[model samples]
Target chain A: LDATAVADAEARQAGLVKPAGALGVLESLSIQLAGIARTCPPAVPGAPAVAVFAGDHGVLAQGVTPWPKDITAVMVEVFRNGGAAINVLSRACGASVTVVDIAVDGDVAEGVGTGAEVLSRKVRRGTADLAKGAAMTRDEALAGLAVGIEIANRLVDGGADLLLTGDMGIGNTTPSAALIAAFTGTDADLVTGRGTGIDDETLNRKTEIVAAAVARTAGVDDAINLLAEVGGLEHAGIAGLVLGGAARGVPVLLDGVIAGSAALVAQRLAPASIDYCIAGHRSVESGHIVALQQLGLRPLVDLDLRLGEGTGAALSVPLVQAAARVLNEMATLESVMAGPDA
Target chain B: LDATAVADAEARQAGLVKPAGALGVLESLSIQLAGIARTCPPAVPGAPAVAVFAGDHGVLAQGVTPWPKDITAVMVEVFRNGGAAINVLSRACGASVTVVDIAVDGDVAEGVGTGAEVLSRKVRRGTADLAKGAAMTRDEALAGLAVGIEIANRLVDGGADLLLTGDMGIGNTTPSAALIAAFTGTDADLVTGRGTGIDDETLNRKTEIVAAAVARTAGVDDAINLLAEVGGLEHAGIAGLVLGGAARGVPVLLDGVIAGSAALVAQRLAPASIDYCIAGHRSVESGHIVALQQLGLRPLVDLDLRLGEGTGAALSVPLVQAAARVLNEMATLESVMAGPDA
Candidate 1:
C-alpha cells in the first residue's frame, strides 16, 4: 500500500461535499482502496471475480458434520451450472464465478459451464484425518497455495479488478476452527461452531476434535506447516488467493469462516497482505469473528451469512464499488460551493 | 404482506440447497419480500429509484447546525447535476435519482439536469423556527406528503420497483431529533446528535432546542399535527414516500435519521406502511437508532452513514436484489440431491 496515496485520499475525503466522517467506514475504505491502487481516487472496481475453491475435509471422518463429503463435488458442479447460492449472488452483483477443484475427493470436470469457469488444479484427492494426524503434507499445502495464486493470477490477468474468496468443503468449519485457534491462541470451544447446522452432541464432538487438532499443531509456528497440520486444502488455496490478490494490488473480499481461516495463514505469510483484504461479512461461525479480530478487519456487511460460497462477499460488491465511485465521481465541497462554473 | 406467500417463501428457503438459517438475514429478507410481493419467489427488483427530498429548516435560525440554510438549495442543484454523494452512489448501484424540492428557502428550477430528474413542488419556502413556534400548518405538511406520493407513483409507474428515501435540508436533523423524541418518548439528549458534524457546544444547544420542540409537541398525538409541530417538509415528504410505496406494494429503502424520523410519521399514519420499509443503514445519529427500534426494523447496512442523500439506501440495492435473486435462482436441495436429472 502507498502511504502517500492514503494521505492524499484522506485529504480528498475531507474536501468532499458531505461532512467529515459522514460516510463513516466508507470514507476509510475509500482511502484504503486509494492506497492499494496508489491513486487519490481509486478506479471504481469493475469485473469482480469470485474464486470458489472446492476441496474435501478429512475431518468429516470424525462425524464433525452431517452432510456427505461428496456434497463438495456436487456443489462444484452446481456452481458451474450457475445454480448455487454463490453463483446466484455473484450474478446478481455482476461478478463472475470460477470454480477451482483444489482437492475435491470426487472428480470435477475442467471447463466452462453456463456462466462459470471451472479449473482443474487438484493438489490431491483428499487429506488424511487431521484428528489423528496432519491434514496434508507440507508439499501438498504448498501445492494448494500455488493453485490459489495461479487462479488469482488468471482472474486478474483476465481483467478481474477485484477478487473474492469462496469455498466448498463439507465439514470444512472443523479445520477452520482448528486453524483459527492454532493461530489466534483461542480455545476450541470458543472458536468452534456447527457447520451446516449440526446438533448439540455433534457440535460438542467437533469442539473436542478441534481442540485436539490445535494441540497437535501447538509446536508449529510457521504458517505453511500450521496450515498443513490443521487446515483443509481449500483453506490453503484461499490463503494463496489473498496473498496473490494483495501482491497484484487488487482487493480480496473474504467470505466466511473458511476464508477467514485462510486469511490468518495469508496474514502470517505476509503481514502486509492483510492490508489488501476486506472482511466481506461477519459469518455466524464463531471462528470467523476471532479471525476477523486477529486480522483487524471490519466487515462491510453483517447478514449472519454462514453459507460460504462467497455469497456474503458477493453481496458487498456494490458497496465496494460505491466507495470508490464516491471518491472518483462526487463533487468536492469546493466544487459545489463554487457553483456550476467550477 | 401476504401470509401465504411468506409461508411459501419459508418453505422454499427450507428446501434450498444451503442449510436452514445459513443465509441468515437474507433468508428472512427474502421471505419478507415474498410477502410484500405476494409471491413465493419475489421478482428481483429491476429498477430502484431514489427520491431525494430537499427542504429548508427555519430551525436553522437556532444555530442547531453550522451549515447555511442556502446549502440545501445548493445540494439540490448538486444532486440534479449528478455530482452529489447520492448521485454517485445511486449510479453505482444502477438506481435513478430524482430530486424533489418539497421545501427550500430559495427558489429551485424544475427540470432535468444531467442524468437526474428535478421536481419543483415546494409546499412552502421553509418551515417556521420550531424553537419559536410550530414548524408548519397541518395543510402544508399534507401538501408535502402529497408531493411525495405523487413522485413515488410517477417513479413506480415509470418502472421503479424499489423506492428509496433521500433528504437534503440544512439544520433538518434538529427537527428529526425532535420528531423521534416526540413519537418514541425518548429524551432529547438521547436522540439529538451533531448534525453534519457539530461541535460539542453546538450539539449541546441543539439538544436543548430538540427538547424544547418535543415539549411543544407533547399534546399533538396525531401524526400530521406532530409533523407540522416539529418536522421538516422533507420528513413529511419522505413519510409519504413510505406510505405511497407501501400502498403500491413496493419496498422503500430508507436513508438515515431524517428518513427514520419520516418513517415514524408514516408508521403512525399507517401502521402497515412500516412493513414496506427497509432500514437501509443505521446512521451515526442517535435518533435513527431509536427510530429503527420503535419501527422494529434492523438496518441492512451499518456503515455509520450520516450523509442522508440516500447514499446508504442506494448502496443496499444490490443486497436487496440479491436476497430476492437467491430465492428465485438458487437450485433447491431436492434438485441437487436428485443428481443431474432433477
Candidate 2:
C-alpha cells in the first residue's frame, strides 16, 4: 500500500461533501482502498469472486459437532449447484462464486457447473484426526496453501479485484478454535464455541480438543507447521488465498472463523498480508472474535452470522464498493460550493 | 404483518442448508420481510428509493453547529445533483434518490434534475427557534408529515418495495437530541452530541439547549404536539415516511440521528410503525443510540456514519436484498439431498 496515496485519500475525504469524519469507518476504508490501489481515490472494485475452499475435517471423528463428515462434500455440490447461502448472497451482491475442492473426502468433478465454477485442487482426501495427531504433514499444508494461492491468482488475473474466502469442512470449527487459540495465546475455552448447534457435552469436548491441540503446538511458532498440526486443509487454502490476494494487492474479504483462523496463518506468514484483508462480518463463533482481534481487523458487518460459506463476506461486497464509490463519485465541498452540479 | 407467514419463514430458514440461526439477524430480518409481504418467502426488496427531506432549523440561531444555515439548501442541491454521499451510496446499492424540499428556507425547484428528483413540498420557510418557542405549529407539523406520507405512497405505488429515510437540515441534530431526550427520558447530556462538528463550549451550550427544550415538553404526551414543539420539519416528514411505509407494508430503512429521532415520533404516533422500520446504521451521534434503543431497533451497519442523506440506509440495500434472496433462492436441505442440482 502506498502511504502517499493514503495521505491523498485522507485529504480527499476531508474535502468531501460530508462533514469531516462523518462517514467514520467508511472514510478510513476509502483511504485504505486508495492506498491499496496506489491512487488518490481507489477505483471501485470490480468483479468480486468468492472462492469456497471445501475440505473434510478429520477432527469430526471426535464428535466436535454432530454433523456427519460427508456433509462437507455434499455442501461443495450444493455450492456448485447454486443451492447454498453463499450462492444466494453472491447473486444478490453481483459477485461470482467459485467452488474449489481442496481436500474433500468425497469425489468432486472439476469443471464449471451450471452455477459456480468447480475446481479440483485436492491435496489430499482428508487429514488425520487433529485431536489425536497432526492434521496433515507440513508438505500437505503447503500444498493446500499453494492451491489457494493459485486459485486467488487465477481469479485476480481473470479480472477479480476483490477476493472473498469461503470454507466448507464439517467440524472445521474445532481446528479453527485450536488455530485461533494457538495464534492468539487465548484460553481454549474462550476461543471455542458450539459449532453448527452442538450440545453442551459436545461443546465441552470440543473445547478440550481445542485446548489439547493448541497445547501440542505451543512451541511451534512456524505458521505452516502450526497449520499442519491443527488447522484443516481449507484453513491452509484460505490462508494461501489471503497471502495470494495480498501479494496481488487485491483486498480479501474474510468470512467467519474458518477465514479468521486462516487469516491468522496468513498474517504469521507475512505480517503485511493483514493490511490487504477486510473482516467481512463478525461470526457467532467465539473464536472468530479472537482471530479478528489478533489480526486487528474490524468486521464490516455484524449480523451474528456463523455460516462460513463466504455468505457473510459476500454480503459486504456492496459496502466495500460504496466506500470506494463515495471517494470517486461524491463531489468535494469546494466543488459543491462552486456549483450545484459540480 | 402476517403471523402465519412469519412462522413459515422461520421454518423455511431452518430448512436452509446452513446451520439453524447461523445467519443470525439476517434470519430474523428475512422472517420480518416475510411477515411484511404476507408470504413465506418475501420477494427480494426491489427498487429501493430514498426520500431525502430537506428542511431548515430555526435552532441554527442557537449556535449548535459550526456549519452555516444555508448548508441545508446547499446540501439539498448537492443531493439533487448526485454529488452527495447519499447519491453515491444509493447508486452503488441500485437505489434511487429523491430530494423533497419539505421546508427549506431557500428556494428549491420541483423537478427531476440530472441526478435526483426534487419535490417541492415546503410547508413553511423554516421552523421557529425551538430554544425560544415551538418549532412549528401543530398544523405545520401535520402538513410536513402529510408530505412525507404522500411521497412514500407515491414511491411504493411506483413499485418501490423499500423506502429509506434521509434528512438535510443544518443544526437539525439540536432538535433531534431534544426529541430523543423527550421521548426516551434520557438526559440531555447523554443524548446531545456534536452535530456536524462543535467545540467544547458549543457542545455544552447545545446540551443546555436540548435540556431546556425537552424540559419545555416534559409532559407533552401527544406525538404531534411534541414534534411541533421540538422537532424540525424534516423530522416530522421522515416520521411520516416511516408511518406511510409501515401502513403500506413496505420496509423503511432509517438513517442517522435525524431519522432515528423521526422514527421515534413515528412510533409515538403509531407504535406499529416501528414494525416496518430497519435501522440502517448507528450514527456517530450519541442521540442516535438513545433513539434506536427506544425504538427497539437493531442497526444493520454500524460504520460510525453520521452523514444523514440516506447514505447509511442506501448502503444496507444489498444486505436487505440478500436477506430476502436467501429465503427465496436457497434450496432447502431436503431439496439438495434430492439431487446434486436440486
Candidate 3:
C-alpha cells in the first residue's frame, strides 16, 4: 500500500460531512481500501467469493475428534448442493462459494463431479496420521499450496474482487493448533481447543497429539516444510491463497483458527503478504487469539464463532463494503462547509 | 415477545447446517428477532429508515462544545438538502432520512421550508442553558417525547421494518453526558468525553458543567423530570422513540453517545423497553459505554465515533438485515446431514 495514498484518503475522510473519524473503523477501512486501490475512491469489492478447501486430517485416527472421517466427504457434498452453513451465509452476503477437494478421502469424479460444483484437485486421499509419523511429504505440501495458488488465480481471474478462506475437514483444527504452536513456539495445551466440541478425553488426546507434532515439526526452516510435518493440506492451501492474493494485490478475508494458522505461515513465506489479509472474526479457540495477536490484525467481528468454512469471513463482507462505500459516496467537508478550515 | 417463538428460533438455528452457535451473535440476534415478530421464522426486516431528531443544546452557550449553535440549523439544512453525513450514509444503507426539527434554534418553516423536506416538530426554540436552570419544563419534555412516539408510530405504520435513532444538535454531547451521569450516578470525569474533539479547557469546563447539572438533577425520581432537568429536546424525543419502538415491537438501532444517553432515560421510563434497543456502535465518548453498561446492552459495532445523527446506526442496518436473512433462509442440519447423531 502506498503511504501517500493512505494519507490522502485519511485527509479526505476527515473532510467528509460527519465529525472527523466519527464513522470509526469504517472510516479507517475506507482509507485502507482507498490506499489499496490507490485512489480517493477505489472500486467497491465486487463479486465476493469464499473458497472452501476440503481435506481429511489423518490425526482423526488418534481419537482427536469424535466426527467420522466420512463426515468430511458428506459435508463437502453438502457444500456442493448449497445446503451447508457457508452456502447459506455466502448467499446472505451476496457472494459465491467454491468447494475444492484438494485432499478429501472421497473421489470427486465419482462424487459431486465438476463443472464448478466441485473442483477435483485431490493431491491424495488423506495424509498419514501425524501422531504416528510425518503427516505428508514436503513435496505433497508444495503441491497442495500450488493447488491453492491455482484456485486463487482462477477465482480472482473469474472476477472475485474479494476472496474468503473456508475449511471443511473434521479434526482440521487439531493441525491448525499444531501449526500455530510450531510457528509461534507456543505451548500445545495453551493453544489447543476442542475441535467440533470434543469431550474431555478427546480434547486431552488432541492436545497431546498437537504437542508431539509440534515437537517433531520444530526447527523446519521453511514454512512449507512445517506444513508438510504438522499442518493439514487446507493450511497449505490457505497459505497459498494468501500468497496469491498478495501477489495479485487483492484482499483476502480470513476465517477462524485454521485461516489464522495459515496466515502465520503465509506471513513467513512473504512477510508483506499479511497486508492483504483481514481477520474476519475471532473464534472461540485459544490459539486463534494467539495467532491474531502475533499477526497484529484485529478481527472485524467478534461473535465467539467456532464454525469454519468462511462463515465468519462471509459475515463481514457487508462491513468491508460499507467501508469503501462511505469513502466513495459520502459528501466531503469542503463540499458542505461554507468557509475556511480555521 | 413470545418465549416459544424464541425457543423455536434457537432450535432451528442450531440445526442450520452449522456447528451449534457457530454464527455467534447473529444466531442469538435471529432468535431475538423471531421473538419480537412473535413467530418461529420472523419476517426479514426490510426497508430501514433513520428519523434524525434535530435540536440545539442550551449547553452551547456554556462553552462546552466549540461549534456554534447555528451549526445545528446549518446541518439540518444540509440534511434537508440531502447533503449531510446522515443523508449520504442512510442512502448507502438503503434507508431514507427524515430530519425532524424538534427543538432547533432556527425556524424550520422559514429556513428549510415546505414539502417533506423537514418534519416540523419543534417544541420550543431550544432548551435553557443546563448549567444555570432546568432545560425544559416537565410538560415540554412530555411533549417532546410525545412527538417522538408519534413519529415512531408513523414510521412503523408506514412500513419501516427497522427504525434507527439519529440526532442533529451542536453541543449536545454535554447534555448527553449529564443525562447519563444523572441516571447512572457516574462521576463527571468518568462519563464526560470531548464532544467533537473539544480542547482540554473546554472538556474540563464541560465536565464541570455536567457535574453541576447532575447534582441539580438528582432526586428527580421520574424519567421525565430528569429529561426536563438536563436533557436536550432530542434526548426526550429519542427516549420517546424507544418507547414507541417498544410499544410497537420495532427494533431501534441507536447511534453514539447522544442515543446512548437517551436510551438510559428510556430504559428507566419502561424497564422492558430496552428489549427493543440495540446499541449501534461504541462511541469515543466515555458516557456512551457507561450508558450501554447501565442498560446491559452490547453495541453491535464499536468504532470510536462521536458524531451523532444516526450515522453509526445506519451503518449497522446491513448487519441487522443479514442476521434476519440468515435465520429465514438458511437450510437446516437435518436437510443436509446424512444420518443420525452418531
Candidate 4:
C-alpha cells in the first residue's frame, strides 16, 4: 500500500529463516517489500524485461565525445546486432532488451525485426541545444514521458515482473547534470562530472554550460518544468519508467547518472515514486553519488563504471534476485530445531 | 580437445554476427569456451551451484577477529540455516549452495541435513597456527586438493557448466595473504589488507604474521609445499576448482582474496590454469588486485567489495552470460542489411 509496507513485506518473507538476521540486508529488503506491497511474500515473478532509451543531444555537436553523433545510430545497430555491452549483459541476466529509438537523427523503420524488439517513438530527431534554447517543449517532454510509461506498461502486461532502466544517449549527461542540480538544489559544479571521458577543457566547459542551464530554469519549481527546460527525451522517458514501475509495483533498477537525474525528477513528480526505485551502482560521476544519497538509496555496486548502457543495472540484477530469493526460500531456526539460545 | 580449443569452440557457437574479432576480448572468450563440453552453441544451463568451504584457524586462538573461534561453528550453523550472505546471494542467482565443513573443532554429522548440503571433509578439525608450525601437513593439502577436484568433476558431470568458488573460514585471510605473498613475490605489507574490518592495530599484527608465514614458505616452489607451509584446505580446494574447471572446461568464477590466493597456488601447479579463470571483482582486499593482475584477468565488476562469500562472482555471472549471449544472439549487419558503413 505504501513504501514502508512494501519494505515490511519483503523483510517478513526474509525473516522466516532458521537463523534470524542471518541473511543480513537481504532480510531487510524483504521487509522493505512488505512495506511497499502491504503483503507478505511479495509475489515477484520471472519474465523481467529491460527498456533502454536511446537518444541524441544537440550538445554533442559541441564535441563532448571523440565519436561522431552518427555513432549513436551505429550503436543502435550494434544493440540490434547483439554486440553491445547491454545486449550481452541482458542475455546473461535472462532479460530481453528493448531499444527505444526516442531521438535518432533519421527515420528508422519501426520494428525492423532486430535481435530484440525496437520501439520507434521519436519525439524529435534530436533535442535543441540547451545553449541556444530549451532542450524540448513542455509538450515534447510530456510526450516522451508518456512513451516511457507506455513501454513499461506494455512490458508489465506482457509478464515482465521487473523493469530495468538503461539509456544510450551521448552528451545526454550534460542535461542530466543540469536537471539534477535544479531538482536537488546543489551547485552545478558539485553535481557534474567529466562524462564520456572528456578532456579537462571540455569538462570545465560542460560544467559551466550545465550551471547556466540550471540557472536559466531557476524559476521553475516543478520537476516537469525542469525536465522540459534541460532534459533530453531519454531522461523524460526514464522518469516515466520510474513512475510506471511504482504504479505497477515492479522494482525499477536505475543505471547511472542519466538515470539518477531522471529518478530525481520522478521523485519530485510523485514523492512515493522512490518506492520502486533501486540504485544499481554509484557511477564515477560526481553527480551520481549526490543524487543517490539525496534519494536515500544505496547502490549495490560501486565500480568506477562510467558506462551508462545499463551495464551497472544488469550486473546488479543477480544481487537483487538474491535478496528476493533469501526472503522466499531460507528455513527458520524453529523448523531446523536450532534454538535461539544455541 | 584441449581447454583452449574447447573454450574457442564454445565462443564460436555463442554466435556473434560480426567477424568475431569486432568484440575483441569477449570474442576471444567465446572462442575459448571456458571448458564447456560442447563448442557449438555452448549452452550454459542455469542450475548454478556455489561451494562455500568453511574452516577454522589455530590463529583464532591468538585473537584475529573480535568474534571468538566458537563463532566459526556458529556461522557454519548460520550458513546451514540459510542465514548468511552467501545464502541470500546464491538464492538470488538461482544457485544451490553447499557448505564444506573442511575444518572445525568437532565432528559434524556426515551429510548433516542443513538447507544446504554439508560436506564434512575436516582436516584435523582445523589447521595448527602457522606461527607455531606448518598450518597443515603436505599430505593433508594434497587430500584437500583432491577433494576439490573430485567435487568439481562431479558437479560438471551433474550438469553444472559454471562453478562459483566461495570460502568461509575465520582468520583464513591471514593464511590466504601469506600464501599470496609467497607466490606473488610481493611484500606481506602490500598484500595483507584489513580483513573483516579489523582495527588498525589488528591489521599491523596481521601483516607481521603473514610476513612471517611467507618467509617460512619462501623456499617452497610447488603447490603442495606451499599449501603445507601456509595454506588453508579451503584455499587448496579452490585452487583445484580453478584447475579442475580448466581441465573439465567449466568456467570457474573466483570470489575474493581467498580464491585469488588459491588461484596463485593453482597457477604454480599448472601455468595454463589461468585459461578457465574469470576474476569476478576487484575486491577491497589489496591482495586481490595483485593476484588479478598477475593472472591477467580483468574483473567484470569493481565494487570495492570485500565480502568473500562468492558474492562478487555471483554479481558477475550476468555479465559473463551477457558476453556469451552477445556472441549468440546479436544479429549480424549482413542479416539486418543495415550496411556496414555507418
Candidate 5:
C-alpha cells in the first residue's frame, strides 16, 4: 500500500460524508491513511505523546551561541518545572511531553523535578566535540537507536497513536546539518543555516566546518556509521524513533531542523519510514527547507517560526486534527442534497 | 476605581515575578490592567462573551465585492453553524460567541439552528447605499446604540467580565472608513483600504466615495450623528458596546477594521473608554493603524490578519489570559530566592 492508495481509502470511508475533494489537503490525508492501513475508515485514536530529547554538544564550548551553555540546563529545569514554551504549547495541545535526558551529564533525578515523566538515557554525558572528534562511536550510535526504538515501543504499548519528536541540544544544528548533508548528498552550504541566530562570519565558519565533517564521511552507508561520524545522540534517537513509528504504523510529527535532519537519516535507514513522517512546519533555519524537500514532506503552517521548543509543531497540531476531523466529520454534499456550486 | 489604575496594578504585579521581563508583552498587559482598574491587583475573571454583530450594507449592491451580498447571510449561517473560522478559534479560546443580526435584510431566524444565541433587532433591512445617501438616520443610529447597550447590559448581568466585539457585515468598510475620517480628521483616501481583497480599480472608487461621505459629515460633534450619517448599525452597536464595557469596567477586545473604527467612535463618545479597549491585532486595513494610534492602544499580535470573524481577538484571548496568569501565577524573586538574573 503506497501513499496515494492510503489517502484514497481513508477518503472513501462511509462515515466521512463530504465529497472526496471537499476538504482539500485534509481529504488527501484521510485517503493516505486508508492506503496505509489497507482499510477504509482508518482509525486514528490519538494518544498524543511528545518526546523532548535533551542533550549537550561539546561544540558549545567553542562559543557558537551568545547564551551560556548552562542556560540549556536551566531551560531543562524550566521544562521540568513546566515553565518552558514547550510546556505551555503542549498543555494547550493536550499532549503529555516527556523530557528524555539522552546526554545531559547529570542524573535526571538531580534536576528540578519535571511534572511530566522523565526518561534518563544519557549517552556518555553528551557527544565528543564534533569539531575535533567523531560525535559518537558506531557502538554508541547503535545504542542511541536502540533507546529511541525502545521509547517508541513504550509509547505505542501505552496506546499512543501519534508521536511528536522534539530536541533540546545547544549547538546541535551543526551536527544535524552534517548528517543531512551526508544523507541527502547535498553540500554543507545548502544544508547549513544559522542556528541560534549566529552572525554572518560565524555562519560562514559553521558552514565550512559542517562541510569538512560531511566530506570526512562521504562513503558512510549504514545508519550507524552515519550516526557515529556526525550525529548527536538525540539526533540518532529521533531517527530511530521515526523508524519505530513506521514499524508500528503510528504518525510522527517532526519538530524543527534537528528533527527534520534526523528524519532524513531514518528514511535512509528504512526507506518506507517516510510513510509515518509529517513535517510540522518549516523553521527559519535555511537547512530545514533542504531537508524537508529531500524527504518530500510539506509543512502545515508557515509563520516565520525559528523557536525550536516544539512550539511550531504544537501550534500546527490543531490544524492536523482539523484535517482529520474534516475528513471524518463534514457532511457530504450528497447527504445535504446540495450541489457543488452551493 | 478607574481603568488606567487597574491596568497599572496588573503590570506591577506582572513585573514582580522571578524574572522581571520573562513574559515579554504579557508583562505590559498586566500593567495595562493596573491603569484600567486603578488598583494594585486588577481583576481578570473569565466572563468571556463574544458579540458577533451581523449586518449588510446597501453599498454591497454596487458589486464592490466578487462575493454576493447573500454571502453575508450564508456566512452568518456558517458562524451560527460552527463552520466559520471564528467558531474554530472561539472554541479553541473557550469563549462563547453570540450572533446578533442587526439591519441585515434576511430572515433572522433562518440560521438560528446553530447553537449561537441570536439577538435580532433590525434597525432596517440594511443601511442606505452610502454612495447615494446617508447609511442611516440619526434616530436609527441612536436606536442601534440602544440595542447594543441593552445587549451589553444583558451580557454583564449574565456574568460576562469581558466583551469581545466582532462584526460580519459585507461592504461595510466604506462606511467604516468614512466614520474614521469623520472622527480622526484624516483624509478618507489615507484611511480607506481594500476591503475583502478588492481590485485596485474598485478600491479607488471606494476610496473616492468614502472621501465624499467624510466631506459631507465633517463637523459632526456627537458620535451618534457621525454614525447616523456614515456608519452601519453594527458599527454603531459595537461603538456602544465599547462604551458599555468602559462604563461597567469590563475589558473589550476590538476585532478588525470595522471594530477599530467603532472603537474610535466610542472613544469620541467617552474619552475614558480607551481604558476598557485592547486592540487585539492590527488588521490589514490601513485605517486600523490610525485608529489604534489615535486611541493610544497597542495591539498584542500583528499577523497582517484581515479575516474578520473575531479570529484575531480569539487568538489573542489565550495571550491575554497568559498575561493575567503571569501576573497571578509566576513565583516572585523573593519567593523563589533564585538569582535576580533569572
Candidate 6:
C-alpha cells in the first residue's frame, strides 16, 4: 500500500457525505482498496470466479468421515452440472465456477463422462493416509501447487477481478484441522471437528487420526515439507491459488477452514500473499478461528457453516465489490460541501 | 410469522445444496421471507428505495452537536441533487432515494428549490426540546407517524419490495439514545454515544439530556406516550414506516440507532411488527446495540458507523436480495440427487 495514496484516500474519505469511518469497516476497506489500486477510486471489481478444487483424501480410509470417498467424484460431477451449493451461490453473485481435479483417486473420468470438460490434473492418486505415513511426496505437493497456480492464472486471465477459494473433498476437513494444528501449534484435540456431522465415536477416531497426522508432521518448518507430510492435495492447490492471485495483485476471498489452512501455507511461502486474501466467513470448524488468527485475517461474516465448497466466499462477493464500489461511487464531502449542500 | 410457512421453508432449506443452516443467517432470513410472503419462495425483492427522513431537533440548543440545524436542509438538497452518501449508496444498490421533510425547521423549500420534487409532509417545524419539556405533543407524534406511514405505503405501492429507514437530523442521535435508554430500561450513561464525534463536555451534556428525557418519561408504559414525550418527529415517522411495512408484509431494513429506536417504538405499538423488520448493521452507537437487543434483531453488518442516513440499510439491499434469491433459484439437493451425480 502506498502511503501517499492512503493519505489521499483518507483525506477524500473525510470529505464524504457522512461522519468519518461511519460506514464501519466498509469505509476502511474502501480506503484500503484505493491504496491498493493507487487511485482515489479503485476500479469496480469485475465479476468474481470461484475455483472449487476437487480431490479425494486418502484419510477417508481412516474412517475420518462417514461419507464415502466416492462422494468426491460425485460432488465434482454435481459441481460441473451446476447443481451444487457452490454453483448456486456463484451464479447468485454473478461469478463463474471452475472445477479442477487436482488429485482425485476415483473414477473421475467417468464422473466427467463425454463432452464434459474437467481439469484432469492429477498429482498421482489421492494423497497417502496421513495417519499411517506422509500424505504425499514433496514433488507431488509441488505438482498440486503448480496445478493450482495454473488455474489461478487462467481465471485471472479470463477477466476475473477476484478469485475465491473452494474445495470438494468429503474427508478434507480432518486434514485441514491437522494442517492448522501443525502450523498454529494448536492442540489436535482442540482444533479437530466432526467433518460432515459424524457420530461421537467417529469424531473421536477422527481426532486420533488428526493427532497422529500432527505428530507425524512435527518438526517440519518448511511450507512444502509441512504440506507434503500431512496436508491434502486440494490444500496445496488452494495455497497455490492464493499465492498466484497475490502474485497477480488481485484479491482472493478465502472460504472457511480449508482455505485458511491453505492461506497459512501461502503466507509461509510468500508473506505478502496474506495481503490478497480476505477471510469470507468463520465456520463451525474450530480450527478456522485459529488458522485465520495465525494469518491475521478477519472474516466478514460469522455463522454455522461447515460445508467446504467456497459457498461462504461466494456469498461475500457482492460485499467485497460493494467495498470497492464505495471508493469510486461515493461523493467526497469536499464535492458535496462545495455544492448546494454547503 | 406463520409457523406452517416457517416449517415449510425449513424443510425446503434442508433439501437445498448445503446442510441444514449451512448457509448461515441467510437460510433463516430466506425462511422468514417465505413466511412473510406466504410462499415457498418469496417474491424477488424489487429495486429498493431509501426514504431519508429529514427532521430537526430543538435539543440542539444544548450544544450536543457542532453541526448547525440547517445542515439537515442542506443535505436534503444534496440528496435531491444525488450528491450525498445516501444518494451514492442507494444508487450503488440500485435503489432510489426519496427525501422526505418530516419536520426540518430550516428553509426546506429553498433546499428543495422550485423545480425539484420532494415529499413535504412536515408534522411541525422541528421537535420540541426534550431537555426542557415534552419533545412532541400527542397530536404531533401521531401526525409524524402518519407521515411515515404514508411514505411507506407510497414506496411499497410504487413497487419497492423493501423500505430502508434513513434519517438526516443533526442532533437526532440524542433522541435516539434517549428512546433506547427509556424503552430498553438501560442506563442513559451506558447507551449514549458521542454523535458525530462530540467533545467531552458535549458528550456529557448529551448524556445528561438523555438522562433527563428518560427520567421525565418514566412510568409511561404506553408506547405512544413514551414516544410523544421524548422522541423526535422523525423517530415517530420511522416507527410509522415500520408499522406500515409490516401491514403490507414488506421487510423494512433498519439503518442504525435511529431505525433501532424507531423499531423499538414500532414494536411497542405492534408486538408482531418486529417480524417485518431486518437490522441493517450494528453501529458505533451503544444505544443501537441496546435497541437491537430489545427488539431481538441481529444486524447484518457491524462497523464503526454512527451516520444515520439509511446508509447502512442501503448497503444491505443486495445481501437481503441474495438471501431471497437463494431460496427461489437454488436447486434442491433432492433435485440434484436425481441428476447425474447421484
Chain A TM-score of each candidate structure, as shown: 0.99, 0.98, 0.95, 0.93, 0.91, 0.95
lDDT of 3 by residue, A87-186 (tens): 7778777788888888899876533422125787888888779898888998999999898899889989989888899999988999899989998989
Candidate 2 Cα outliers beyond 4 Å, as residue runs? A340-342, B340-342
The DockQ values of the predictions, listed in order, are: 0.89, 0.90, 0.58, 0.23, 0.09, 0.55
State which candidate has the highest DockQ: 2
Q: For model 1, what is the alpha-carbon lDDT of residue A21?
A: 92
Interface RMSD measured for model 6: 2.1
Which parts of model 5 are misplaced by more than 4 Å?
A: A1-47, A66-78, A81-85, A110-114, A173-231, A242-257, A260-307, A315-342, B1-47, B66-89, B107-114, B142-146, B173-230, B246-251, B254-307, B315-342
For each candidate, give its TM-score against the true structure. 0.98, 0.98, 0.94, 0.79, 0.73, 0.95
Q: What value does the lDDT take at residue A137 in candidate 3?
A: 94
* Candidate numbers sorted by DockQ from highest down: 2, 1, 3, 6, 4, 5
List lDDT for all candidates, in order.
Answer: 0.91, 0.90, 0.83, 0.75, 0.73, 0.83
Q: Report residue B84 deviation for candidate 5 (angstroms).
A: 5.0
Docking category of candidate 1: high
The digit string of per-residue lDDT tens for model 4 on B1-342 reads 355656665445444333223234444555544344345445654766788787888877666666566656766776776766677666666677777777776656556444467888776688888877788899888878887887788778877778999888778888888887888899999999877778888888888888887887766787788887888888978887888877886888888889988999888898887777888777778988888878887776665556676777776676566556655555544544456553
Fnat per candidate: 0.97, 0.98, 0.57, 0.29, 0.00, 0.54
Task: Tell me the tens digit of each residue's lDDT in model 5 across B106-133.
Answer: 8877345453677787889889988787
Candidate 6 per-residue C-alpha lDDT over B1-342 given as tens digits, one digit per residue, 9 for 90 to 100: 777878888888889876666677888888988888878788768768788888999999989999988888878877787766776677677787887898999766634432123688888888888899998899898888898899899999889888999999989999999999889899999999987888888899999989998999878888888888889988998999999999998889999999999889899889898998999888888888889888998888665667788878877777787788878877776776687545
lDDT by residue (tens digit), candidate 4, A123-215: 999898886678889999999999889988988888887788888877888988998898889998998887766778888888888888888
lDDT for model 6: 0.83
Q: Model 5 - which docking category?
A: incorrect
lDDT of 6 by residue, A14-55 (tens): 777777777677777777667666677778777688888888
- Spell out the clash pairs found in candidate 6: A15-A333, A16-A333, A22-B305, A24-B304
How many angstroms is residue B163 displaced in model 6 relative to the true structure, after the best TM-score fit? 1.5
Q: Name the 10 consecutive residues with the lowest summed lDDT in model 6 chain A.
A: A109-118
Best by lDDT: 1
The DockQ value obtained for model 3 is 0.58
